[model samples]
Target: MPAPLIWLGAACLGLYASNKANVAYLKHHDIVDAMPGESDQKSIPVNGSIVTCGIYGVLDHTGIWYENTIYELSGKGLVRCVSPERFLGNRSGTHIYVACKPNNKVLANCLAANRARKQLFTLLDYHLFDQNCHRFVAEMLVNHEVAVTSFSDLNTFLSEFFDVPIKWNRALVKK
Candidate 1:
């Protein structure tokens, strides 16, 4: 066997090991898994709750739930509010998950909703991995600059902000 082939096999094994370790770390931190299609029954979200919906079963789009609508950052960087149906439209999944406590109690801060509402029609420089929906939601909650890039990152921030482990509850779309 060629020496280069042996080195390539070693590198592949190392990569696999690194991936497994990363997964273990994320699970240990209690990062909320925002993957969609996990629930069938619809649920009502509390105002100011952090909501998320799956995008193509791989990414999660986040927003702040206020009143009967969801305040989200559009792909074009416009901050707007929309109905739950509109939120799920054109998405790969139909369920929107709300952030809650481990005991299934909805976790929310009214101030977050107020902040989001105040920012309506605001335009931002949206970046897919940097200045995206997650950062927008985080900012709405904290009213400060928060660098959140992924669902798990936002969940971790929420856990610390609320001082508890965060859980995802499927939100109900009222007719």
Candidate 2:
């Protein structure tokens, strides 16, 4: 092999190994400047663009503004920073299937039980906020299309479950 080509292959391998390790760290952490309520709101700013570019493309949602080049959200609920080279690999199109093993089963049950209310709620009925099932189950979704009317109820719900003032929620309404 040519000297230059051999060095290129070694470089690619090094980058790939580095990215795989860093992704695990970025996915589970909130960046330094992130607001407190970002997790509950489902809004996260990711520095990794390698993963996010394809995520938006898959969801058909765009106009995403960010400072870094590789900021993208993966289907697994992992918002990550992607490298320019790895950006296209993340573009498999379906994000609904994440790490949850029973996600499909739970979602299916919910759709069957409540014809009116769509997604998540049905699955959450059987799931709880335990160590095993803490990630996806929402205590309340409050969608206008299906009409979940409760500012008071929502506040009560969070307090009872989380025991913290979802105090940052106030910031969302200010503007």
Task: Give the count of colliding residue pairs in each prediction.
Answer: 1, 13
Best by TM-score: 1
Tens-place lDDT digits, model 1, residues 114-143 = 999999999999999899999999988889
lDDT of 2 at 107: 11
Q: Native-vs-model 2 lDDT? A: 0.26
- Using lDDT as the measure, the top candidate is 1
Off by over 4 Å in 1: 1-24, 33-43
lDDT of 1: 0.80
Error of 2 at 111 (Å): 36
In model 2, what is the error at residue 158, expressed in angstroms? 24
- For model 2 the local lDDT of residue 110 reads 28
**Alpha carbon lDDT of each predicted model:** 0.80, 0.26
Consecutive 10-residue window with the lowest summed lDDT within model 2: 98-107
